[model samples]
Target: MDRALELAARGPAHGPNPRVGCVILAPATPGIPGRTVLGEGWHRGAGTPHAEVAALADARARGHDTRGATAVVTLEPCHHTGRTGPCTRALLDAGITDVVHALADPGVTSGGGADHLRAHGVHVTAGPRSAAALDLVHTWHHAVTTGRPWITLKTATSLDGRVAASDGTSQWITGPQARAHAHAIRAQVDAIAVTTGTALADDPALTARTPTGTLAPHQPLRVVIGHRDLPADHRLLHDGPPPLHLRTHDVGDVLAALHHHEIRHLLVEGGPALAGALLAADVVDELHAYIAPVLLGDGPPAIPPYGITTLATAPRWHTTTTHRLGDDILLIARRTATHPDPDTEEA
Candidate 1:
């Protein structure tokens, strides 16, 4: 199970598919209680061979007999044919006898894999090392279950929750460590989004850069949300990849378009209005705030008031995690279980 978890962790940082790992163990020989590991493999992304099939192929290449072998996998073997063939069929064809899976596949079309394996007479053990497997595909699960991308609102603010000074001079608000951390977050998302206000004000490239300022090898798609066209010479247009222009103010419309593009995780680096709109639409899945130890009493608010007039009506978050990065503090928060609308707030 630990090997399976490790292989699952090697998957891409961001993509539309879930990360999965698999290990094949030959039956225990004689008095030895432990089985010999015959092969190991992990899924890279969509359109790739599944972990089970990869491991089975590796075992075959090494001249290891797979008959009566146990397949230990992080997630349940998929039973539906997607970009690749069904993993359940692969396991059966490989002559795998027993299966140990961490998490059940939650996908609507690819779920119930454990049942199919049992129907085929394969002994199955579910939920072995489940917590780690679930964390491996946290956002992917949310996207598959909700039919929309998981949105994370990321912001750099002052101690008093100010995003900029009174004059709108917001450069270098956080130290190098905090900025680097933010860039790392950008690298792990399918797309980076901002509003027209930010695009015009900052002219941000929206491309993830390494700590040394070079562009990252795998860049997220850059998107600007609003009804107006950007300036002819906007830097984002000439960056690593051309920016995707979404001419709309409706958060639902923006999310729908991204969903169609198969974006699983979206990182919103805000200007206030767009953040307010996402919050008001109640589509935000997580908040990543980097708060520096400074006060800008007269600057623009980090988030504009969106009908949050009374204390009782203010938004609340749960499971906040705090980390100190240089002179800044990174605060991550997720919506509580009691929060309305697990799926679009039932509008």
Candidate 2:
């Protein structure tokens, strides 16, 4: 299960599909009494073979006997076919007799996989490192459950919590390494969004670039959301694909519109009002903040007032990771769960 989880993380950071991995263990034999690894694979992205299928193919290509093998998968085998055939069918075809998975897929279109496998007489075991597996695809899971893109608000601020100085000169708040890391993050998600005020003022090109300043192969859709028009010569309008100009200040409307366009993961590069609006609406899922060592006393706060007059109403998050980037520290936190998981409850 730990190996499967590690493989799952090798998939794209964020996309329309959830990250998944699979490992095939051969049945006990005379020479190898314990389980021996036959093959291993991880899902790449959309329009590609799923994890189970990939692992099975790997075993087949290596001339390994897959008959009666057990499949260890990070996610439950999907039963419904979309771009490819069902993974459950693939496993059954490969002569897999036993199956173990970390988490059941929550998607309505491609769910109920464990039951299908059991109904077909395959021995099944579940809940091995389930929490770790869920965390692997939590953003995609949240997006699937809520029917909207999951957001991660990225901000660079001083130790005192200010984004820019009083003069509005906000360039280079974080060091070079932190900015490079931020660009790497932008390369993973489907879209990077900001408000019109930010668009007009910063005129950010918003392209995911390499450390050498070259454009990365994967670039996010640059988006500006607000009820204001940007100038024609702005780099955002001409840099990459045409910007997704969402002409509205309504946070719900903005998210719904982005969802309509099939944006599964959204990275918000903010000024203040836009981030605060999302915070007030409680739509933001993750917070990615880069804290610089310097403290600017007379600068704008990274996030302005939202509506937490009392301490109890304040937004709380669970810190997922922290890493040092040059002189800055990147802190990532995620929203606390509001409801219990049915699978966990069942377990």
Candidate 3:
């Protein structure tokens, strides 16, 4: 399973599909304590060959007999055919004797793969190293379970929690290292989002540029919200991928539109007005904040007041990670709990 996890880590970092790994073990040799590993493979992304089929093909190409071999995989072998054929059929065709899977597929279109394999006389064991598999697909699972994209709200602020100086001179708040880290986050998500206020003030290109000022190949879709017209020459309008202008104040509508575009994860990098609205709607899943060691006594807050009347009324977040980027500290947090049902909530 550890090998499977390692292989799964090789999958793409920016996509809606879950990362999955597979290893095929041939019949044990006389002196070997365990079966010999014949092949290994991991799923790259959606519309690609699944892990099981890849591993089976690799083993066959090596002239390894796959009959009665054991297949260890990170995710439950898929049963239905969508972008690719069912993995269960692949395993059966390869004459797999036993199958060990880490996590079950909870997707509406792809669950029950284990049951189908079991009914077909394959020995299927579930939940070995399940935590690792679950971790790899957390964002994808959240996006699939809820009809919304997983939002990661990123803000760079001063030590006093101000986003900018009093006079609105906010360029280069963080150092070069921190800015690079922010661009890395931008590169990982399916889309980078902002509000009308930010579009008018910053005129950001919203492209995931590298340290050398070159654009990354996997540029996220640029998303601008609110009913406002952008200048024709704006970089976001003509720089990289075609920008998505959502002329709506409704957060749900914005997310629904993104979901329809197959955007599983989004990075929200906008002003306090947009951040406050997303927080109030309880739609944000993660918060990524970068705090420089400088103090801005009086300036725009990183996040506007959320109308919390008392301490108990305030939203709670649990720290997931913290680190330093140059002189700035990066903090990642997740809400204690998501609202039971967010579809009925107002934006």
For model 3, residues 77-185, the per-residue Cα lDDT tens digits are: 8888888989989999999989999988888888888999899898999999998898887778788889788999999999999988999988878899899988988
Residues 1-347 of candidate 1 have per-residue lDDT tens digits of: 99999999999969878899999999879987888999999998888888999899899889999999999999999999978999999999989999999988988899988999999999999987898898999888888888888999998999999988999898888999999999888888999999888898899988788999987777898989987788878898765667888999987889889988889999999878999999998888899999999988888988998878875556788757988999999999997646545455554
Q: Which one wins by lDDT: 2 or 3? A: 2
Q: What is the overall TM-score of model 2 with all chains considered together?
A: 0.89
lDDT of 2 by residue, 144-178 (tens): 77888999999999999999999988888899999
Off by more than 4 A, model 1: 338-347
- Summed backbone clashes in each candidate are 0, 0, 0
Against the hidden reference, what TM-scores do the models get?
0.93, 0.89, 0.93
lDDT of 1 at 40: 90
Model 3, stretches more than 4 Å misplaced? 29-32, 337-347
The better candidate by TM-score, 1 or 2, is: 1
Candidate 2 C-alpha RMSD relative to the actual structure: 5.8
lDDT against the true structure, per candidate, is: 0.89, 0.90, 0.88
| Candidates by lDDT, descending order | 2, 1, 3
